[model samples]
Target: MRPTGPLATIRNRAAAVAYPVFYRLPRGLRRWLVRRVAPTYTVGAVVLLYDIDQAGDRTGQLLLLRQPGNRGWSLPAGLLDRGERPIDGAARELAEETGVELTTGQLTPATPNAVIHHHGRWVDVVFEAQAPATETTLRVDGAEVHDAAWHPLADLPPLSRATARLLAHYGISSPHTPLDPQPTSGQPDQPGPA
Candidate 1:
């Protein structure tokens, strides 16, 4: 139950005055308290690993990972570990899913900053990187990621909900892009689920 009337005002004022004292606590305790009291949401990073077919030519081919189970095809994405930077998270996920390693500077932000859901629950931070199509070698573990392939923008396989939405936000402009059916407007969707 929430405090009401004078009690609510008192609680707010107390918290405001105690703000400095709160910072004196250990970092781990502070994080734990925040998680216990604050709303929960995930911060994920996704990468559009584009390939250049010819020298200085954009091929429109991007790497997609075929994750095991019902995830279908999706981009290189994963939730950021606690306190991980977005670019570092993107690079880590890309290297983990596909055997392509890239420096954080090699990736560029694809969205305005991060793509937040309408319900303001989860965020998908997008990044784009380019590599030579012929020179890029992809290796998947065949378990976490069943396959890794470079798919042209004109032809794409059935995509997971997160991938579909992120692509649209990145200006794919494909009306026929098959987006998964969402449960409802009020419900927040997972950026990527196993």
Candidate 2:
């Protein structure tokens, strides 16, 4: 949720006046201003799609994607398209980032459906959805997303800061720091000592 009361009113009013001015600036100057002067306010949806591990009798793993913008794995996330609801946005992003298709009805708001101002510049609408572990398939387009996979909640590849914060919000501790995941014994990527 966005800030409310007097501060929000002021910010909204400022944006109202600024939008036209911002758009009118020359493209190069606009780009420079974006980097130096203003922080873009964006609303997006992030999903923690867990596997329903019936045999293990617990939530199996989380679906993560390797996006061009992130240095490491990130949860399925995208900015809400014009006039889109948060849940529907989440469903769309999940389908686009990973090949998994989920209906809005299948998504459970993570503890609460309220907007989360997560790490970095995200105003996120977060959801937790589940599907059968073995039946789910993953695909990446290679243009925007390079990889997609289900990873154990405890043991994860290096994660984006936003992903780590979202997991930590649920009390799931991430072993590695956001940018670099430390090699753990038995993990497929863990390198043997030289």
Best by TM-score: 1
Please give the RMSD of candidate 2 to the true structure: 10.4
Which pairs clash in model 1? none
Give the Cα error of residue 27 in candidate 2, in Å. Answer: 29
| Per-model tally of clashing residue pairs | 0, 0
Candidate 1 stretches with Cα past 4 Å from truth are 1-34, 118-120, 173-177, 180-194
- Model 2 segments beyond 4 Å from truth? 1-40, 55-57, 118-121, 178-194
How many clashes in candidate 1?
A: 0
- For residue 149, model 2's alpha carbon misses the true position, in angstroms, by 0.8
Cα lDDT tens digits for candidate 1, 1-194: 88789989999999998898889999999999999999876788988888886675788887888887645578898889999998999999999999999999899988566777745478878888998868888988888899899887887777776677667666662344565565565233554531
The top-ranked prediction according to lDDT is: 1
lDDT of 2 by residue, 74-181 (tens): 788888998999899999988997888999998878864544452234467789888876888788899978998888887887876656655655666557754235
Residue 16 CA error for candidate 2 (Å)?
Answer: 23
